[model samples]
Target: GAGVSQSPSNKVTEKGKDVELRCDPISGHTALYWYRQSLGQGLEFLIYFQGNSAPDKSGLPSDRFSAERTGGSVSTLTIQRTQQEDSAVYLCASSRDSNQPQHFGDGTRLSIL
Candidate 1:
């Protein structure tokens, strides 16, 4: 029940709907990252947070995708107006620093209809 945990291991949503996925990172970890892996694709970084470092959302596919970290520990990723192209395994990881090897949790499989 430690390390990292993600909610709604599986989510089914209709296209154009909004959904939120939560991530609980390891205690005391200062770096958190959001990534998504589509079928046969490498992990794609969406955003990252480390201490007060500004988050990098350059990898976010669209404005519909956003994330926020709270207390520098828990984070939530929200996808608005989800589309079929957004369907993928959303993964969350955290590390001691941005350059550290992030520990990942079983991702939330989002299916958009």
Candidate 2:
């Protein structure tokens, strides 16, 4: 509600199970982004949505990963047929615009068994 908010701070699922992570950005932010952080790795950009423009999916690791922003306020990241390699902290960030600094959420810790 105040800053960026992510659902289910932690998630554990069996391999091959699909999972969806949600992000609720600040009230008026126009830019939303999704990133993944492996154990010691830096944030890996996954996707970006700005206003009504087309989302930039260039950073997505595979076809099984997808994300969408709705009504310019909320976003969802869906991972299909999850694998062990997919286990990581999924982070969400939002900014007033693409040029502005972002506010990050605590992130969802996903574990694949």
Candidate 3:
């Protein structure tokens, strides 16, 4: 893909179930980010991975959320013990570096029932 790619455009799961979302960044992008956006709310940063450096997970809202970037190309975000409040659009973005402009994927819409 020319741009960032995300899988499972929509997800519906039970409140206590877990879900994993995937993202494939551009070929040479060194920075990847995970964000969540609730209805009518702005994007909430979740985590960031850059090259071989450790990931910055400071923006994660709770222990239930976690993400990993493998081989500096693919990333996955996992949400455990999901709750209704966790419903939102999970977005993935990539950039050449921290200071570069990011290209975003369409996002995976998650709905907790």
Q: TM-scores for all candidates?
A: 0.93, 0.94, 0.94
For each candidate, the alpha-carbon lDDT, in order, equals 0.89, 0.91, 0.92
lDDT of 1 by residue, 1-113 (tens): 48789998999999999999999998888998889999867789899888645468788899898888878788999999999999999999989887788899898999998
Whole-structure CA lDDT of model 2 = 0.91
Per-prediction RMSD in angstroms? 1.5, 1.3, 1.3
Candidate 2 structure quality by residue, lDDT tens digits, 1-113? 58899998999999999999999999899999899999777889988899645468898999999888879888989999999999999999999999999999999999999
In TM-score terms, candidate 2 sits at 0.94
Estimate, for each residue in 1-113, the C-alpha lDDT of model 3 and write its tens digit.
59899999999999999999999999999999999999776889889999745468998989999888889899999999999999999999999999999999999999999
Weakest ten-residue segment in model 3 by summed lDDT: 51-60
Better of 1 and 3 by TM-score: 3
Q: Which stretches of candidate 2 lie over 4 Å from their true place?
A: none
> Clashes per prediction?
0, 0, 0
**lDDT (0-100) at residue 102 of candidate 3?**
98
Task: Show pairs that collide, candidate 1.
Answer: none
Error of 2 at 37 (Å): 0.6
